[model samples]
Target chain A: MNEREVIETLKMIQEEKLDIRTITMGISLRDCADESAKKSCGRIRDKIRRVAGRLAAVGDEIEESYGVPIINRRIAVTPISLVAESSRTDDYLPFALALEDAARDADVNFIGGFSALVHKGMTGGDRKLIDSIPRALAGTDRVCASVNVATTRAGINMDAVSLMGKTIREIAEATKDRGSVGCARLVVFANAPEDNPFMAGAFHGVGEAEAVINVGISGPGVIKSALEKIRGSDLETVAETIKRTSFKITRVGQLVAREAARRLGVPFGIVDVSLAPTPAVGDSVAFILEEMGLESCGAPGSTAALMLLNDAVKKGGLMASSFVGGLSGAFIPVSEDLGMIEAASRGSLSIEKLEAMTAVCSVGLDMIAIPGDTTADTIAAIIADEAAIGVANNKTTAVRVIPVVGRKAGDVVEFGGLLGRAPVIPVSRFASSDFIGRGGRIPAPLQSYRN
Target chain B: MKAIITVVGKDKVGIIAAVSAELAGCGVNILDISQTIMQDNFTMMMSVDLSGSSVSLKELKARLNGIGERMGLVINMYNEELFNSMHRV
Candidate 1:
């Protein structure tokens, strides 16, 4: 701890906006299953409440003692579909309600895992859970829902993809009074990670320990500021600079994750080395891309720039932590990033370009607001396209588009707080109903044949 | 445990005196101190040993922040582990 290092760290915190984005305790609920939904929900709630009781207080203590801001304290439970499968009742709304109750009791921000994994095909419980998503998300405030519709190994489940498209539309319609904010809490995934700490995509997988603590690091501002100092440098130098910055940022996350896990007496899960952005000025992933010499985000060469940035971040972060999992790359959620929002509003960025960018970055078209008239088929097509990228590349990608009800293109949807606001970006008018209607498994690609 | 205390604000009289007095009152030993003035703003950084201090680290931080507020300065206290973990491998 030399003087220069101390000053540099302080600067990163004060000026560069480095902070731990979340400390998510992943609690497995497999043992809580029961034949009766009532008893099952009761056991689920008790398990979450007991496991994550000290999460928020511990997060606060760490933040205060270390002088690093921990933005969120959340919990991720095992996919409810698996846990509630033994229950006879078809409705899974009670499961979502129980999750919300436990989240409230534990005093966490969001609780994930109201989810079903039907990448290959759907089970009876998975179908019921998928059917109840719209109602579940609409009714519960803290519960987030996700469905893994594609995987590199299992291929894409077109039936489930189509179902999710319709589910999202139903969710939007059910919560239209709140500007369809419920849809924001639902994520459709391809190759979803088991230990992700970010939401609405995080869920505890079956293979994980009974309980674990995972951390997500955020510092788009720090990386952007670091690149700002190396302006006019070559592409290689730019990548190197980003790598160094990510290394420093991820080390802090590793520290916090270890300390939190120790205090909570939970096994430490992987550190998600993602540069998650906020709507605040200077705290944006798009700004990092633009600082790399793009005229604006979504411009030509934006994907190339993002690819370099993402690869470098992972390269640097891998050395900082021994166990790095989750979506360890850059996130380009439009509404959560001021630069992307400005670009979208001005037409400098479009949904098409965003789709292309997702081919290279971590997540797919995220936090984007589409026109109210956008059809379920089109959203499903969008998800399919992003899934193709993830499946082909063997990486994780997710879609969390909110189609603001009654708002057409050129309108703005205000979802204030960390969710931020989004300008309604127009979707393709050309229909994809015929393609989505032809629902069957898009068989695993050639790349998936390596085994 | 070691902690670094940094103070930054417009240059003024008795800034060091008041800060050191507060630390000494809490039985915190200052191992190293550095001060600089750039463009009429004063900046000070100190390496202090808190293991011998009677007050908890949180209390010392709060006390130092209070002193900083009264002196129209900004003070930050961070555990040295934060720097070591970030900078050293």
Candidate 2:
């Protein structure tokens, strides 16, 4: 063992906040489906508890033994819509509640997959699951929900997009007392990944194995700390530093992922090396972009900075881990990042700039708060625009904006914890109801037609 | 079967003697040891073979943590594979 490298690794953990963000166990709930809703919910709960009973314990073991904090233990199940659709029910809230109960039993903080993949169209169950999202999220504390209204292969479903806008509004209204925090747990996505270990968007795709363990490695602080050492260096050196740092970070993720999978007797899945930021000042991806000579994260050169970062992160992480998937780039959740919060609050970071950054960064329009009076059509339009970007680029995009009820622009809303605090930023005043009212599918872009 | 133990804190007499005594009592054989004073603080690194030890890794950590808290030092024992995985690979 090299003492110098040991000291460096320990220093990275002790001061630089290098840590495994999440260890997510993806369990297929396909076998839990039944014609009866009650039976289906019961089976779902039982299977989750049985398969994931040791998940949190194993995560704790890995954390303690490796000296890396595994911050979250999560479970992403097969989308409830696929299972609940076979059940004779219009309401899928019971399925969400079952997930909530199972996660609590297993001592997991968050359980994702109260979701529907309706990029092409919505079936009866998909519509039911989407309809029940507001109620499920408002009622459960740990259950997360996602709706994929667009994909590179399927294009955008304007009807689903329109419905999601209304659904988000309903969630805002239902959880109004909690600063509309329920909306924070709901993510609307374009080209959503099947094995994402991150919350509000993770789900086990149908083609995935019966059970798998996917890990998300987060180290914005680690990368920033590395960049600080090479100050005054050129962009080429900065990119190289990021790539090298990312490789080391992803190796930690691979170690934890393989250990967790071994202990849980589940097949190992991908390691999502997303520079997932939190509310902590030291752990901000925005600060990394700022560290690369930008005045602030959302400055004029920010998109280029983020593009270099995203590409380098993917390149570095691809070789370190056996499997690399999910939104494997830098995440810019405005509310969840301290530097981004500072920039957005100072008016340097705008929604328009974020949309551009999304084209280069990992996901799109994430955790942004807009005006309360923003219409559903306008929200739908925003989703449509973001979806267009994802489909055209053949990448994933998502919108998890909270239109805080009765709050206008320039107000702050605290959702607390990892969801963080968001500032209510302004959007365009121009209306797009006509375009949204024409509720039909936006055809798949030329880029998506690749065979 | 192998582990790396890192101890960092203020320099003190009998630090090595106390740590080695604990390892000897637990039947853990120290393969190599390195000690240095970086700046003003004392730092020690140990590569140990734990295959013959009677204690589990979790229990060994608890014991070391007790010693650390009393000595005003930070002590950590991790599976050696962790170092090889991150720093080597």
Give lDDT tens digits, candidate 1, residues A54-173.
999999999988999999999999999999999999999999999999999999879999999999999999999999999998998999999999999989999999998999999999
Supply the DockQ value of model 2: 0.70
Q: lDDT by residue for model 2 over A1-451, one digit each (tens)?
A: 7789888888888899999999999999999999999999999999999999999999888887788999999999999999999999888889999999999999998999998999999899998999899999999999999999998788899999999989999998998898888888889999999999998899998999999999999999999999999999999998899999899999999999999999999999999989999999799999999898888778899999999999999888988999999778999999999999999999899999999999998988999989988888899899999998999888999999998988899999998889899889999999999889999998887763466
> Which 10 residues in a row give candidate 2 chain A its minimum summed lDDT?
A442-451
Give residue A446's error in model 2 in angstroms.
1.3
TM-score of 1: 0.97
Q: What is the lDDT of residue A380 in candidate 1?
A: 94
Clashing pairs in 1: none
For every candidate, C-alpha RMSD to the true structure in Å: 1.7, 1.7
Evaluate model 1 with DockQ and give the value.
0.78
